[model samples]
Target: MQDMIFDNNQVLAVGSEPFLSRFDLNGKILSRMPCAPQSAFSVSLHPSGVTAIGGYGGLVDVISQVRSHYCTFRCSRT
Candidate 1:
């Protein structure tokens, strides 16, 4: 897994296909979801029940209430 965050007695991890997953303390996967096309590198939870996954190519996936939205940014190298 590339990144993980613990909340509400569950573990949220981001990685390969099924990029975002939630696991119980016993390591059983409770739920899984796709994030970005590229590998996810970070995961964060919001107080408002929103989830954000950051990945390559300046892509970020935001999930709220079972709905997903992708945001992108352009980066320039000097």
Candidate 2:
């Protein structure tokens, strides 16, 4: 797994798969939702129930509370 964050007693993880997975405290996976392809290296949860994932090639994906994708974008090197 590349990154993980705790949310409401659950663990949200991102990794090499194109998925964002949720697990319990014991490490049993609860759910997996598609995110960025290939890899995701960072994850953060927002107070508004949104999730932001940073992935390969500077890709960023935003997901909503209901497990739906909000948007995708890319960061340019400055």
- Candidate 2 runs further than 4 Å off: none
lDDT by residue (2-65, candidate 1, tens digit) is 8999879999998765478889999999988876647888888998878888877767778874
| Residue pairs that clash (backbone atoms under 3 angstroms), model 1 | none
User: What's the TM-score of every candidate structure?
Assistant: 0.79, 0.92
lDDT of 2: 0.93
Tens-digit lDDT track of model 2 for 1-78: 999999999999999898999999999999999886569999999999999999998899999999899999988987
**Per-residue error (Å), model 1, residue 77:** 6.9
Q: lDDT score, residue 18, model 2?
A: 88
User: Top TM-score: which candidate number?
Assistant: 2
Highest lDDT scorer? 2
lDDT of each: 0.77, 0.93
